[model samples]
Target chain A: MQKEKPYKVKLSIMPFWSPLTPPMGIACLKSYLEQNGYSVRTKDYNAISSLFDFGGRYIALMKSYTPVDRMGNIAMVGYDVLMAHLIAYNNRDDFSLNDYHELVRQLILNNFFYEATDEAIENLCELVEQFYALLAEYLINDIKEKDFDVYGISCYSLTLGPSIFAFKFVKKYFPEVKTVMGGGIFADQFNSNSLELETFARKATYIDYFLLGEGEIILLNLLESNFKNVPRIIVSDKTVKKVCLDDIPLPDFSDFDMNSYPQLVAYSSRSCPFQCGFCSETVQWGKYRNKREEKVVFELRSLTKKYGKNIIVLTDSLLNPNIDKLADALLEVPPEERFYWDTYLRVCDMAEDMEKVKKWRKAGLYRVRLGIESGSQHVLDLMDKRITIEKIKSNLQNLADAGLKISTFWVVGFPGETKEDFHETLDLLREIKDNLYEVDPHPFYFYPSGQVDSESWEKIYGYESIYEDKYNEMLMCTYYKLNCQPCREEIYRRLELFRERCEECNIPNPYSLIDIYHADKRWKKLHKAAVPMLNDLIHSGSAIVDEYRDSIVLR
Target chain B: MEMERKGIIEVLAAIFPNQTIDIGDDDSFIDKLGMDSISFVSYVIGIESKFDIEVPDEYSLPSKLDTLNKTYDLLGRERG
Candidate 1:
């Protein structure tokens, strides 16, 4: 009574990046493919030793400099790797595949944190020599085993380097299979950055197709009809608008190794409703949309049943527009079965309601990350953040009273922000330091898709250069050489003082995970247990250190 | 409380389980093993937890943990 499934595809989440959360886009595509009666397989190669083992080694080395946290240590090491390549590149305007990979290969072998002696470098390279062969063999066998017609990869800012490595592996070994690349990184990158496309895209010539916008529909169209031409790169003349959020199926996470990630990401909404000039999130997501409350509740219920009491982070934009209905559905989850969760929430008069805040906390809302943006009303208006300081202070009190942790994000170094305006952030920090769980002040970055800021840079102001001169488009690290009021140095000093104030007020100045256990008498014991468990999961190579005896120092 | 060879190896293996360590009790850690100053502190933490000893501030220096045999003697001599 069942139709035979013939189509096979391999969706891969590459390594040397964040292991705190699984790639939700890949999981969504897998679910869609299976529902369409296609055989789908995934390679969460991020779980392997090549990435995690390297993190463990680097962490062990860097502990003397400063202690790294249990979460996001992998990404920390990845940036260090990227830095080594940048140093080797030495601002070269031209590059070749052989030279670039040679630098990467040199990094994998030696100078993880620092330059190694000849003997140590030799030992390190010999230890990882098996890794190169393993990657090639793995890709070849997987393509043959799955009888894969297509391979998809998920790329983000930090993953740009390693994703290319995986791309190369597929190109060299399984060249016949069609390679498709799609993720948040490529959404708006295809537009008018033709110089970026020309230089960056040509290096990766093996890729047959690129799906733009929401990946689910684009991927379905490509695989279902064996179609390659789409509104991507220069030649394609089609760009698909995103389907409504309710149309997307619950992500099939069975293909992922959940043990490798620090927390599970449960999606509820997409894009941000507010068009703040500072963010490029809308460029990737197109428009704001929410899944039906019942459908969202169903996804949560299934996830909870599978992984009991795991920390679930809602990977949504600035705020969920349907906050009330989302809370109502969360109430249906049994208290014991309920998972601890957090999401970005907007601050407004309605959010300041004490009764609603209490209800949301009872439904397992442990933390709420607020995009306060700036403490000064003038700067908030300039950035088009449609909220008031009074509303935020009021809601901060309400959320704290409901026994919920607060993570307020303040963006410093905004265009036209004066020193007097930055002091307002210090004033706001002093007001809520005790009640807050964390206060993160992010530096302003110039992203390619940030229209208002880019216009202000050249037209309104005289900031000439945008990104790094060489390989600007391909490398996604967003930084700018801006000539602005309250220069980066002054912003840096004020942030240091703000950090000191947080420390004085006994607040943890961390943006990663937070806990209410800090107030409990048994907090120390609970923290000790949680740290190792979290550390093991986020850096998975600890499990197989014995297998690769030369990689670590055994007594 | 004399330290045992098996216990030290077990603790070291737990921390860095992948490497083939050539142990010499008298060989300096910097000389025999390729570990740096930063990695030694982690080994000290393992030492403290495994042997039920508090590694004093002075014991944290690489000079104190220089040799395998000297380190074992120091551990057995200064148990907590």
Candidate 2:
């Protein structure tokens, strides 16, 4: 552990999916530590914590005196087109909140933050302490002008609470720079719980080393050799290595500004060729490898022509692991410079390809997502998902008739699942709620690497541990003292009274263009006092995402 | 091009992944592998889905299919 010369190593990657992309496991560990030499640098302070928590939640939702006569100037130009595509991509061309969501309504942009108060999570915890005093003034100016040693961050369990609020101000103002942590939520909650590595060794005791799983040859053997021969170099060891997927590299993202982002992410399969036992996505990337879909269409055409962008976003947990070699490599691209991706497949990989999902939808494979966690094949065979509830209703009608765009990732309590398998998953969401374009429901989230703390899920249902659920105060959620056939709080109170009986049977929520105006009881009590300043512009985006980080990270 | 010759051998086994791409018939298709302008529109979307045939935007064309008999007589005159 010694570094003096020009060994400069920085890496950063903090704030939530950094305004949408560029921290792909710290740009493949800064291209495998600059092809095994060293000198690496990356910051993406969640792209400046998504331009100051989306430009301070659109200046706290244009001073919300919410009368919405023209829905508050279309919810303040959909928060300035989602904060000018989360700040001028500086990586490419922009303008988004999905292009003024063709004039606002995914429930007026989900009622522009409909449920976020406790004074909008204390004004998103004061814009997450001014986004951790702007990552403690960029790690105290890279520890006084990059006289670097080592400092990786990458954590992803809702950016591990903004990498423990920037590893407690980089040990209170660059305490002799040397921290490190690795991604996929400290490689699936470090060695699956000893109370999550004794609460991450007492909140990452200024993390000297924790590079657990596939962190490129334990971050090129803890930054180019030293520290007693590396391999799973966790200082206080947990041991996990993984690299040779045909010698990993090709991911530089040249220290990022990849035209900022909102697309362009690669991975044509890593760990997910179906390990679905209420997946903790193969805890620390182990099996299911795929890459060569012609090297994922030549790294999506040389990283979308060096990030000019052509909409990719693959981050493969299971992107068609050989849908006829992903429709013979998206039918050899070039259908108008093909590459429009958007992955995640398994509803049994679009139920055995409807003619190679119509040549992977003319090789751009538009949006797919679908974990369809359960429509009850006895709770998808207690989540082992050997699939069959008629291949999750004929693979969501063959990926919406192979035109794609379907979105879903359902899960509603799974212990021994029953109220007749939650009324056959609300009769398979009221029989494919019109070929569902988006649903995203969740309830059962008790992970220590989900297989619900196995002993074969406690020798056929018994779990025993119930009551932990803290969720904030550095996470704590254990739950499961069941021992029976249906009890995750009576299946999370019949899935919150089955989402108020799918908004009293209007059943919409494919991300809200209409839940028939919140299935009104007088426009849901006059749009809940007409958006009380859209809950301080939706929990000031909880100073850049951490709340149940959408229920336990993995995927 | 008997079976439009295995869809140009699955677009040269998807642009040479784990190689051994044996294309011949006077190999040129824009000087063989450097056909930029996006791999010549992915080699005309592998010759319009390998002769599922649509190649006509008023046919008559051949600055170079350079040869498998000019990429099978430009797909038999864009399949007539």
Candidate 3:
């Protein structure tokens, strides 16, 4: 047997993706290919996008630690608008920019993007067009500068439209380059019909191969087969070539300019263990998998040494799954050599284990992010969250007492969440306000195929998935309306109340600037006057953040 | 200076309602007035809009505009 000649492979990620950290998807592919003796080059076109003036401001809002409530909705609208344009571009039909503005206005009228003003919507439409043109120019110029056998684009939730847009440029200008599209987004099933899959399939002429599931094994197989006799749609799960978590080589970040990013990223695990009904992690990744604890620690140390970064952000869905073995391994690293890291964790009895929690802090777990979700135990049980309110409160205190900065997420409108249940959530926030470092309150969304027992739960919750008129077909996820108390408007009212409660309690919201600005703008429109409620919210939330920052300065 | 100070107070009052923000010209925002970072930024934007001026990017920080006198001076420079 002879070693196959390595293909000149180049993988890239497009804009609307965050530049705060190097993407783990392409890094994994580059390492898998290079280890198998292939030449690989990777580029962070997102970092390049951030270099543009408007792009800088757009991405700064993303980087401002804003929660997904309004900001995420705005990003969703942008993604949809770009997708509409891409469809027209692929069909060689003219897409009127004003049509997109009207589409957004209709979305606004249809109870979506309610946070955006008409003026903001207009600017967002123009910005999306400008960014698409600029990114296309940058991508084409880079393709001209290099020659590669395969060009891969890693698409995520926000990057799908832009990713395909970039691939169109490559297919048009560099036809010889075998264009491949792959990412976790492909594995995500947002609706019952999988509209995104169908939409992309229509334009599949621009893409040579669409790799589903994990890319490492499928990519290796494609390269070994010399890109011949391969199916246009390669599903990793269906194929026999599957990758085990432990066997894959460490992700190579050398291709990325590590200095441009604030934190270095690595994952100790893939997928998540819990099956929360509202979450889509288990849907995208069928089951949970973890690397050996020693392997994880070794990778963290290697990344810190190689990149000279002191802050590491573990991209794991939940570190609690392997926190015991992983934290113990990390403790073995001498304190002086230990790098600070943070990750998402589940609230369970393990958090109450003061000894283990303190050991995690000693092991340099800088911040702990928890999906507290709700305060009503009934609502929590409804979501299959499995953790009790008593346990949640005690666990929050234990983690805070162990000197961990706790950032929490609260979902305002779960299916069965009553007004009393919402107040319970507010009460829970007030109870743990002293311990919380950041508060992120989000409105609930239903994805038919993205969650566990989604269909059955939809029946149980008595809600139907309607394709929200003509404009919503371009949306990545399905639109749903609850047919009970606390309808959409009620949910938004509660969401506003939730934000006001956090401000009233003086718990720092990371997105207070954007939140207050939008609130002030909306208030002026509705009431025709400047109000003190906005100021009160800001003044209260600001005190906590100012004090928090001042303590950091003192430390 | 007095007119500017009076106008600044009116703007601050509108921005930070429900509070009695008593301060001398030399009083510090953080220590004397308890103005948090968010309040400070809001105040700057408020004063800029009220005065029809734009503060330089460098002087928008709370530390640079800690005192009403300091804010007044910065506005004078920007207005010049």
lDDT of candidate 3 over A124-219, digit per residue (tens): 555566766777667767788766889998877556667767777788877888888888666454221356466556546778887777688888
Give candidate 2 regions above 4 Å deviation.
Answer: A1-23, A26-28, A31-37, A40-210, A213-225, A228-251, A254-263, A266-305, A312-372, A375-404, A410-413, A433-555, B1-50, B53-80
Chain B TM-scores, listed for every candidate in order, come to 0.75, 0.27, 0.87
Q: Which pairs clash in model 3?
A: none
Task: Mark the 10 consecutive residues where model 1 chain A has the least summed lDDT.
Answer: A544-553
Local accuracy of candidate 2 as per-residue lDDT tens digits, A278-369 = 66666666676676667767777888766656666787787655655766666666644544667777766545666656556555565678
Residue A184 accuracy (lDDT) in model 2: 70
Error of 3 at A100 (Å): 2.1
TM-scores of all predicted structures: 0.71, 0.30, 0.74
- Report the candidate with higher TM-score, 1 versus 3: 3
Question: Scored by Cα lDDT, where does model 1 land?
Answer: 0.58
lDDT, candidate 3, at B67: 81
Query: Which of the two, 1 or 3, has more lDDT?
Result: 3
Write one digit per residue (lDDT tens) for candidate 3, span B7-59.
Answer: 88887787567767688988876676556445665777687778998666445
- Candidates' interface RMSDs, in order? 11.9, 22.8, 10.4
Per-residue error for A64 in candidate 1, Å, reads 6.9
Better of 2 and 3 by DockQ: 3
> In model 2, which residue pairs have backbone atoms overlapping below 3 Å?
A91-A258, A91-A259, A91-A260, A92-A259, A106-A512, A107-A512
Tens-digit lDDT string for candidate 1 (A1-555): 136365578888764455556667788888877877777777776555333344334333333332222112222333444433433332223466444444444453322233334544333333234333555565566665546777788765445555666676677777877788777655433433424444456656767776655777667777667554544342212355465667766777787656545567777887778777877666656667788889887887777567542456788885457677787787777644555567788887666776677567655565688888888999999898888888888988877655566777777778878878877877887887656766666656553444435556645555534333333433423334457765645554555555565556665543122122222212223222111222222334223121111121212
DockQ-derived CAPRI band for the predicted complex in model 1:
incorrect
